[model samples]
Target: MTHIDSATAGPVSGAVRGDGLDARLVVERGSFRLDVALTAAPGDVVALLGPNGAGKTTALRALAGLTPLTGGHLRLDGDSLDRTPPESRPVGVVFQDYLLFPHLSALDNVAFGPRCQGASKADARAQAAQWLDRMGLADHAGARPRRLSGGQAQRVALARALATRPRLLLLDEPLAALDARTRLDVRAQLRRHLTEFEAVAVLVTHDPLDAMVLADRLVVIEHGRIVQEGAPSDIARHPRTDYIAQLVGLNLYKGRAEGHAVRLDAGPAITTTEDLTGPAFVAFPPGAVTLYRDRPTGSSARNLWRCEVAGLETHGDQIRADLTGELPLAADLTTVAAAELDLQPGATVWATVKAAQTHAYPA
Candidate 1:
């Protein structure tokens, strides 16, 4: 669907690598547990993105061997790691809070990993210095963890993780520590480093923008399970659940299809461009929906669902109307349009959207 030239669309430089990480981790803590299956190809950076308490951290912890699995398996670079311990696995982790030792200098902190792996103190510090140089922290290598800025500490944490030459890199809320202004700068730097890493890297984040910009694919977890997993842009445009829909601020409905439209058995008859004639989904941004108190006469829009307003709320400068009738849908209207219609909860309304504005795909 893009106009990009074919020559510009060639594959990333390198031979095709095998699936970098193939894992099915089942972890339990108290009454809460996580059962997740995830796979990432070599050179791929997948993001575990979800809301708070959605098991994003739990899943990442499982992968890094920080949390023991009740069952399921883990494989990395085609090798089985069924019994690998956290200290033994070729995995590197950057914890949410950095977890850098406050008493250690940035160089010593990075040196710890290689040192624990049996490198001599001199050898470890030499490798650590090289990593700090690679991370552009050569001058700050002697600085203690508490003295470094947040972004600087994060870079040191990353350098420490990479010191061991890990096959699977795990990052938990990597940018959640920085200020908003620093986040932008660190994000760009992180993206460049991720692109250069030849092995698989996984990061968990709650920020949608971070997931979209830093990952090749996003694995969305809800209720301890993966609710959606796909390229970031795809998930953004077609989310499946109310949480994801609201997270992305789009209207989504599932129903039966016939020709260019899908009739929601529970809601509305929505039209779309998909050619399939069976079960499908029709989705659009709330902003694409138009609401009117009275149905327009001879309107060119082919789909119209009459409904009663259930609730109304302000979304930034726009108003979002929650409707209940033939179909439940969220429609956005300008303040002026809402005032003109005198829209309120329990008010009767007609929602219309053209087929061209609607997107339909397989559910």
Candidate 2:
């Protein structure tokens, strides 16, 4: 495997030079084809989010020149790196496992990158010391990978990547290895470091919280293509696909809209506040759904469906019930309510949602 290191190389193509990162990554393996176009300005942190087998890793590998692109182009800081070797490209990667050499101390590990780039041993060590100090790991400089904590090792890895002064930085699940308590502290610290970075940073992560917290913009990929891209707030408010909706914790349905009603493709019609024609999407938060053991007569809710509890799980102090029936959806209720309703798999219930709670947008 080619490790990320700094190298001086000329542009391989006559393509117009552009600032930051501009690339259309295309990779083909067997029947899987990944085609993703990514552009980021200097100092921008973009997060690539997707489910398993969604090609998130493939796209990251393509950008780092680890997985060769069968098509598309790669450019960074006005230089075309389409044909640049992995060791020759000015790209730095912080792998999921941190990938620190067990035999090297934290300081030596950080210095390794600059040393490989031909910096003098003294200069490389000096630079590494500064980075360790910046990462607040100066106290652990002499510690080996086994001695450092998860968060400390992650910072060391990041310091090592940044030591090369690469124009494009790639972080693969940088916080995935940390424990919940450690992840909270490290995530905030990582955000600060990313903000101070002057180069383009691309992070691939499966955790929605990681993406929403660390990235300035989010690019959601599904089955090898970008399903949606936008600010975290915007994407959270309006999701275009089921994958995105689920990620943001919203119940989404696609249908044809006529006035205040949308006839869903899944054999149901939803009432929304928006009036429109043609294909549309209606979405509501799981909390907006109310479940009842017996159907209530003369309820004010505009939408009601007979549903059966498919499963139940605890979601942040609330009981999240997955229902399958008239309209497959999820509902969040207090534990007390769950106990009162006797919610369990195979239990029949009535689900209700007020029209005001549903938002509809053009598809």
Candidate 3:
């Protein structure tokens, strides 16, 4: 299959133009401008992950030519698609809500793309049947959009997109519309389909787990900018920003690193095994924290801070305590320990963490 390979027209400065889809999209509105550069090779599954309104959808729209770029360039398969209309682009998009036509049956919906491209009615139906059969929805080909379940509708949307034989596929929160129970099953099925796609695929999702499971690479965006891009495991182990740290469930602090100790800007200091200078970030999991009702005597822990219980909640089988004081952090403890210590909001406690438990890296 001939897919988007490479292009050099209106080359973007510092843009990656190796193979497959290469784009440097810039959209300018009053008081807000989204400028993001994206590149994906053939058979690569990339996920655009970020908080809401971080321009993920805008980037996807720009790639499909649904949204015009005020600056920068978009190229696919050695062809400059900067001025191409949305329908002409060799791209397919699966919207968050599926966006299936309510009046159309599953077979008709899947056949619509081929029919629009001048395929005969009989041929379109035949091709559509093949796609529906692949999606395991041939039994429901006569069912209308409203009659199908959430997972079935999602599969139909995917079939419709794939029926066009697009070189680039874009999925925006593909499982967001389904309930939690249905999302699990649909996610696994979607992962299987994505693995089989032999073209550039980009999926937009805010859920970290979904992004990790679906995409080979993750592009984290915030405030219309790409902050971090790497493998999911690397991003989880070393978060560059507090937003990412929070999303990955870690307590992150910025400080000036000394030999084996770092003095926090928040008034407390922490000791770590990492030896560095200048600015640094110290991160530790909530489970690393140990709380004591009274100051523990002769404790070997290098980091100790007096904090008040700001809140308490159940996290899995353990209780997570939100603390605030000299150093704000979260502590997770067993329910038995919480009951024994009489932990509650507004109660003062001493939190300790060993130097070995903290991971410090240059910021």
Best by TM-score: 2
Q: lDDT by residue for model 3 over 1-363, one digit each (tens)?
A: 001111212222233465677777788766567777777777788888777777788888888887788888887766799998999888988999999999999999999999988999999999999999999999999999999999999999999999999989999889999999999999999999999998889998879889889988877777777777777887788898888888788999988999888888877889999998989888999999999999999888989999999999999899999999989999999999999999999999999999999999887
Q: Would you list the C-alpha lDDT of every candidate in the order shown?
A: 0.82, 0.89, 0.86
- Candidate 1, residues 1-363: lDDT per residue as tens digits? 000011111222231434578777777677676777777777889887667777877777777777777877788887878778888999999887899999999999999999999999999999999999988999999999889999999999999999998999999889998999999999999999899987889888878888899999877777677777778888888888777877787888888898887878676577777776888878888888888889888788888888999999998899989889877889888999999999988999988888889888877
Least accurate 10 contiguous residues by lDDT in model 2: 1-10
Clash list (residue pairs), candidate 2: none
Candidate 1 at 49: error in angstroms? 2.9
Candidate 1 — which pairs collide?
267-326, 267-327
Distance from true position, residue 214, model 2, in Å? 0.6
Error of 3 at 208 (Å): 0.7
lDDT of 1 at 289: 84
Clashing pairs in 3: 4-77, 5-77, 6-78
Report lDDT (Cα) of residue 307, candidate 3.
Answer: 97
Tens-digit lDDT track of model 2 for 2-43: 111111111222223498887887787887878787888888
Estimate the Cα RMSD of every predicted model relative to the unseen true structure. 6.5, 5.0, 4.7
